[model samples]
Target: MRLPRPGEPRRQFVKRFLLLAAYSRVLTADWNGTLLAEIKPPKRPTFGMMRLRLSDFPALQNDFGSVRIGTSALTANNPLGLLYPILINRATQGQFYALLSECTHAGCAVRPYSKESGACVCPCHGSRYAIDGRRTAGPAFFPLLQYPIQFDGINTLSIELPDLPHEIEGSLVRTLPGAEFRLQLRFLAFAHLEYEVVFRASKTDDWRNVQFSLTPEAPLNRSFVSGADDYLNLYVEPAAGLGFFAVTIRILPV
Candidate 1:
């Protein structure tokens, strides 16, 4: 949750944070109630190149028209989870440009370009970006990351994305009672990965792997939703004292 220390390398910082994140736990409260733990998902993976038909988005058909492609729609290609593709024209010539939706200032997702303001605005800090993803106003100084896109002069567009690590967003909700505890973890599962839920009685106790049951009683989908996707529910019947829980993920060999 904290930023990397000064002079720390990016790779080292990420590795350290991820190692700490896997073992972090929430202290038990005084009363028997529900506790919510915020688990930050890793970054989504990139599948090299993605192809999209311009006809699929009605807004991208005209000059200056734009559309936002979210992780829900891009379950297959997984192109950075959030993208803003805009139609830019010079005189009678028209072209398409794809911009990463994350704001440069604080990493908040930027909204679609507003025709009235003619810029994409960040809801968190009011950072404004032009139709071409250039920083136009507000606190951000750097432009949005732009993906290399090629238009076929017809209805198809090809976007090339750099290879990046794959990660998913997930949440853990826990309920504590008089003599038992329950945890419900919801996350997007990928094909070449494995997940495990672990528990500990207190901060000083060692974590032990716990058994869980899938909610849908079926397979999981690629698309991720907070309450949808796949839920791993673990119930400890004779749990004593305070309980701590965490989810650990592993990338399987291809």
Candidate 2:
């Protein structure tokens, strides 16, 4: 994907690329790492500040030591999966750097900092980035994207993110008969968000989590669908006459 040109509308640029991706027949394998263990967000969901205590990561206590934050594992291709992973490295005592792991070359995720080389290496094409995220070697001419961090000069680091959406737009359909039914769920999903599917028998019943096996095995991406929309086909065992379902979305912490 090409970067937005200077003065170009970012949302428009992303929309255009997403539209192209929808029509493209090539299916890129997800190169992001596995999801991290669940971590509770701030008490107020609307707050966008991500707080990390330096004490939690022993690696961050020393210079050049680093840690990854977000839902997915860090890898060399498209740091973006369900969420964009933030690579945080301690530059010096009371100083740190936070960078978006996506390599500028081909949007691949850069590997973790190598103390031996004193830089992060892009496995895809051997692009090298300095500890501060500057481009140190080529194939990639631009530096890794960096986010500002506020440190208390002690043990806490605070990073602010854009306000996340509280709700997603989607429609659900149920079909099939007999012993089982198939629920087709289509929703608009932002790259920065995570989602969960829940169901209930009726209006008065409490919503319950569905089995993992029932979740969509693969997301449908086609030209007919909007670029931002995700398609899921859920196979469910019926309880009785009717059922209700919902998709809950949340922003992943940085």
Candidate 3:
């Protein structure tokens, strides 16, 4: 190998360094396609997580859409995770206020009435709730919970409902006493974290591990290797999980 001659300028070195980083994607990428760039994640638990997209409910608009969700098809078992039985208030159509698609009698999903009926009919017992949430027929003694629409003045709207409420995420694990998880990572760029890792608890249903990156970018923990913020071996035995454990990488802001 020939020894190259060099008398490089400091400014030139900086420029070259910057250029290399700008082009680092092509040169330093893991060709096996196992890695992604460092990502920014949400800082809080109440961040918006939509299991069902709004495109699923096109009728909702402005602030009204913000509160109601279409979870008729979503399989998430958590009640807060499900947003079905959406309430249609006066703002949505005339003065009608009710969960338009839920049966007022047997708690079966309410079937939308044909245009001729203009009344919501229960599929189970044929009981009826009016265009509004009141009981209009047999069996259903109580009216469906009446919720109103309130505009919060922002692009987001307020939907008031009694039957379904929001779900709170499990708490984060701040104490890593012997039972902790170690992740090995190589960041392609400067990373800001949201909720980075979700480790399923092995012990039981309630056990879970969820955490947010405190720094703008996370601090890496590695053993047996000394490198940049780039490469680190993550060593962890998750607090929640049995032998057949699963993990979820949460990069998107909630």
How are the candidates ranked when ordered by lDDT, highest leading? 2, 1, 3
TM-score of each: 0.43, 0.49, 0.34
lDDT (tens digit, per residue) of candidate 3 on 159-247: 43332222212212322554433322222121221122323333344324444333223443311222232322232322432322122
lDDT of 1 by residue, 1-254 (tens): 12223244434322111111111011221111111122233234433445565664555566666555432222222222233222221112566667777778877767666666788788777999888889999999899888777788888766655442222222222342332223234334333335555567775676676666554232322222222334333332224445655545432211
What is candidate 3's local distance difference test score? 0.33
Task: State how far residue 226 of model 2 sits from its true place (Å).
Answer: 21
Index of the highest-TM-score prediction: 2
Of 1 and 3, the candidate ahead on lDDT is: 1
lDDT of 2 by residue, 1-254 (tens): 12223244434321100100100001222222222121124345543455666665667677777665554323336534544556787787667888877788987777667677888888889999998899999699899888777889888877654332222222222333333333344445544345555557776676675542334333322212112335433333334456655544333222
lDDT on C-alpha atoms for all candidate structures: 0.46, 0.52, 0.33
Top candidate on lDDT is 2
Once model 1 is optimally superposed onto the true structure by TM-score, how far is the C-alpha of residue 248 displaced, in angstroms?
24
Count: clashes, candidate 1: 0
TM-score of 2: 0.49
